[model samples]
Target: MKALVIGGGIAGLLAARVLTETCDDVVVLERDKLSDVPEPRAGVPQGRHVHGLLVRGGEIMEGLFPGLYDELVQAGAHLMDAGEMRILNPLGWVASTRTGLPLLVVSRPLLETHLRRRLTAKIVDDVHVTGLSFRGSTVDGVLTRNGRVDADLVVDASGRSSKLPSWLAEAGITVPEPDVVDSRTGYATRLYTAPPDFPVVIAESLSAPDTPRGGIVMRIEGDRLMVTAQGAGGDHPSREPEGFQEFLDSLRGPIAEMLTDAEPLTPVYLFARTASRRLAFEQTPGWPGGLVAVGDAVCVFNPVYGQGMTVAAMGALLFRRHQDFSAKGCRDFQRKVAKIAQGAWALSSNADQSWASEHHAPGPLKRAFGWYMKKWQVALTHDQDMFARFVRVVHLVDSPAALMNPVVFRRLAKYSRQDPRRGRRRAGSNPR
Candidate 1:
């Protein structure tokens, strides 16, 4: 069978890798002329910002590309223990201890470079896909700028700007309106030369309603350090160097202090189009055969939570479980993709709802969840075990329900009532 995959980003690359298991001819069409080097592409502007694959995302990727982890580390990527990483929550610093789960800390460019090199599919760059091609109600292939390229299966992983909805509309089909939760998030990122003692991964928590500013500093491949400063509710981190440093100084923790010794290698780059949106394509009445949507084409998440890549990885993993390529098969997979994205969507969208968002109303349930999580952040300040459970949940390694168990609930009930910012419950020693 011949499969046509759109886009050459991580989602498309992973989907193409998965398809290679069943299809002999798997072709990935990328719009931009991909650089042989591990540099950011024009299409993926967010590539310039800080990024990390959740543990599950890293596992999914490593599974698709055997020995990929070792290869990355050899090329200067870091394999850091999750417990060793530090987080500054609104309440205080989360206690650190060994948790066994390791973080694969690498930049988007480095990760993409490795994945593309290891991918077994044919990657054709500079090919712009215009629309879908069909034969008697069945999807035959995708129509590109050059001409129609025929295929038995088509996967859309074209990212946030995907035109699948309009393409379907041209076929007399319609898709449901996307569920949106926009917090008006923006990011300002820069590369730097880390000091020898700089922490591998460190972040200041940025949730809505209280702390609208957050940032992370990560050491990636080539011994380089990447720092991303972010703000929600239109309080964007400034692109100018002076303003960027000012924004960093406004954070609650040591983000600014930690960077004092680091030398910047690049000017601050700004990215502003971050919103949590999920297109209900699975719920569409009539989905054609030989078609599937993955990654940002299906759902997009706030980068602040680091769920987009993981959710997309999870969606790619679904392809291996289903093999029916019929119209019903495609529809079934799409439905499953919706279910897969649900948890991450809940997290990002609900978190955004906690902000004063016009796109989503924080009904009682969302507001309550947000409140509990915020208080739980306070609780994490004093309890390492609780923080570990919360970390696993954030990494998609464990269920969110884990944080709501009786033990955690009982503890939070006792400790989370006081906000540390008020100087009331700040008894514990917060170690960096």
Candidate 2:
């Protein structure tokens, strides 16, 4: 089988590598001239900002490419035990417990470059996928600017801005209207050199009934730090140096002071128009055959949660299991992945909805669940088990249902009132 993967981002490249094992030949089509080294491209706008491969994401990447974790660490990616780091939940400080899995922190470019080198396939750059080359209901290949390339399957791993829906429509497939949850958020990121002892510090001012400002700082490759601050709605952060610092200070805690002392590396990179979008591809009854959509092309979540790469990896794994380059296989694959995407989409967007002035009232179930989850967040500040469970869901190692399981809830109920004063004292000692 020949596989033609559209978009050369992480999802496309990873899918190509996996498909190459089962297919006769694999080709990746990328619109932008992807950088061979660790650098930003026009396609991945979020590459200019901070990104972290959660513990679950790292594990999946390793499964795809053996020894990939060490390869990334040696390339300047920082691997930190989630337990050693301090985390502040909406309620308070999340208690530290050793989560055996470690998160990999690096610029998106470094990770992509490493993956590209390992895959050993020449990424066909500068070619834009214009449409599908199909025969009746079967997709034969993709029509690109360079011309047509024949294939048995065409996987649209294109990022969020994918034109596949339009292409499919032009090819005569009517897609269902996408489910869009706009957060109307903006992000500004800058690089800094921090104290060697305290490399990465994450401080968040979570969205509440009143405040909706948040920020994250992580130790990336090159011993540098990447800090990003986000404001809800049109609460945009200024691009000026002084104003940027002020924005950081306006965040909940010590991030402002820590950033003030760190050595500045790059200018502030600003990104706006962030919205959680989910395309209901599974609901399209007339969906075409031999064509599949993966990655952000299917669902784009708020990057603040850092779920994109991990979710994409999981989606690729799903494709391998459910899709066999057939039209019906494509439809089944979309439906299965859509179920996974909806869970993550709800998790992130529902959180975004909490920004009071933003005005997103979730349904009764979401509202009630959100209320309990907030209590769980408070429980996480004091209970190690709760923190572990919360992180498990955040990293997608476990399903959201796991957090709501009777086991976790029963534990939370048992421990919430056991020892508040003692918990605060112990948590206070461990400064991030």
Candidate 3:
């Protein structure tokens, strides 16, 4: 068997990596020439922006490419307990405690470059894949700038700018309009020089309605640090130095002061396209055989949630664990992958929903859930157990359902009743 993967990003590379189990030949076609050095590329517009590797994502990647974590650390990636970082959410500050969940802090470019170096499959760079080539109703290969490349399976891992919709339409496949929920948030990132021991990271999330501005101070490879400032609901961070600093200053906490001591090495890079979108390819009638999609090609979450890379890893794992390899099995694969996308979509869209309530009319159940989550975030500030649960959920190690345990429900019920005007009051005070 042979597999062809288009768009040699993390998802595509992972697909190629996993297909090696059943396929003798697997080829990944990437548009831009992938860099050997750890630097941003044009292929990933948000490469310069802040990116994350959730705990579950790190676990999946490590399983796919063993020793990758150690290799990354050797290459200067920061590996630390997730709880060591100081986090400020909409409710209040999240207390720092050891939760044993590890965080791999590295630039998107650096992480990609390291992961690329480990791929055993042949990667053909500078190859622009235009569309999928089908044999009858089954996808057989891909049409590229050079020519058609044959394969038994084709996986579309192209990200936010995927053109699979047009390709499917050409094949007479009718797909419904995808669900799109935009956060309307934008962020600006800048690089700075820092010592090896940069201490702990400081982050303040973009709170909704009342406060929509936030930022983070974290370290990466090359003995450098990254400071990212963000503003949601159209209050965006600027690309210029003065404006970037001003934007940071406007956020709550010491988000702006975190950058005061650091020496700037790069100008601010601003990105505003932070919408959460999902494409229901699996639900479409007469889905094509011998074709599958993983990662942003199928769903894109608000990057603020940091779910993209982890969800992509999960999709890759699904492709590997799947038993069937024939064209007929492709339909099942798409559906299964859709489930993984759904789990992540709920988290991303729900967070953005709060900021988009004016445009959205969520049912009573959803509104109640959203209300509970806000209180839950506040609970994270005071309650250690709740904080741990929240951390695990965010890291993809635990499902959101875990936060709705009977014990937590009782605690939240009690906390909600106490004086609403209590300054900085937190939920889950009594762990009973």
Candidate 4:
């Protein structure tokens, strides 16, 4: 089989990597001329910001590219123990406890380049994929600036800026309508280099009643730190240095003090394309054969939650598992990938809706669910086991349905009664 993958981002590379297992010849078409070295690209503005591969996604990627994790570590990526990683919810501090999973902390561009290097297929960079070439009902190949190269299959792994729908329309296919959930959130990121032994702190605020400030500071490749400040709704972070420090000060505690003393390596890089969007390609009628979409082309989540890369890896894994490459294979692959994207879309948008307030009041279920989630967070603080269980859900290792487990609920209730004051503190406190 001959396969042509559009986009050379993490998702595009992942698709090519997996498809190579079945296709005899595979080629990746990338718009930007990616450097042999790991560096940011003009097309991926978000790559300038902080990013981390979640435990589940990290594991999947590691399996896909053996020894790549070690390469990243040697390249200066921090391997944080999942259990030891600190997280602050609306409730108080979530203690660092090991869950036996490790998170890969590296710059997004570095991660993408490192993953791409593992693929054996040819990557044609500096070429824009204008659209898909087709005949009758089959996708024959992709139209590029150079020309068209015929292929048996085409995979759209383009990120959030994908124009697959328009390409499909041009090819006589009716793309499905998309479901959008806009949060109007905004964030600013900057790089800092601290002393070799400076304290490593990762803090954030969960969107909740009363307070709204949140930030994350973690060690990335080299002696550098990636600090990102975020706000719910239209609350945008400052672009100036002084205003940036003030934003950190607005957080709970210690986070501000540490950031105040740390050294800044780069100016505050601001971006505001924060929204939860999911494409309903699986629902589209008369879908054409020999073509499929993956990655942000399929779903885009609020980066605040760090779901995009992880969900993209999961989508690629789904394709790998199914080993689908034909017309029927395209349909089945899209359906499965959509299911995976739905879980993440629901998790992020549901959380974002909670802070809508009068600006964007949610429907009945979302409002009700948010209320319960607040209590559940409090439960996590009082019960270490509950926190562990909940962390699995948060990391996408387990489903949200796991929260409904009877035993877990009972334990939370018992812990709350045993220490009401502590429970309240845990419930009300936000982690950095």
- Models 1 onward score TM values of 0.96, 0.93, 0.95, 0.93
Q: Candidate 3: worst 10 consecutive residues by lDDT? A: 423-432
The true-versus-predicted C-alpha distance at residue 302 of model 2, in Å, is: 0.6
Every model's Cα RMSD, please?
A: 2.0, 2.6, 3.3, 2.6
- The TM-score of predicted model 3 comes to 0.95
lDDT of 2: 0.78
In model 4, residue pairs whose N, Cα or C atoms come closer than 3 Å (at least 3 residues apart or on different chains), thus clashing, are: 83-97, 83-98, 88-431, 91-427, 91-429, 92-426, 92-429, 203-432, 204-432
- Cα displacement (angstroms), candidate 2, residue 28, comes to 0.6
Give a tens-digit lDDT track for model 1, residues 65-131: 9899999999898998777788877766777777889789998999999999999899999999999
Candidate with the larger lDDT of 2 and 3: 3
Q: Which ten residues in a row have the lowest lDDT in candidate 4?
A: 423-432
RMSD of 1: 2.0
Candidate 3 lDDT over residue span 66-123, tens digit each: 9999999998888898866777776667756789998888789888988789999999
Give the range of the ten consecutive residues with the poorest summed lDDT in model 1: 423-432
Global lDDT of each model?
Answer: 0.86, 0.78, 0.81, 0.77
The residue-by-residue lDDT of candidate 4 on 1-432, one tens digit each, is 898988898888888888888889999988988898877898787888877577778888899999988998998887776766666666566655667767777889788888877889889889888988877778888888788889888889888899998887876678767766666677888888765654454766656545567888878777888888888767778999889888877776456666556788889989888777788888776677788899999898888888888888888877567765566777888889988877777778887765554446667887778766766767765566777777687778888789877897677566545533454443223343
Stretches of candidate 3 above 4 Å error? 195-197, 325-328, 419-432
Instruction: State which candidate, 1 or 3, has the greater lDDT.
Output: 1
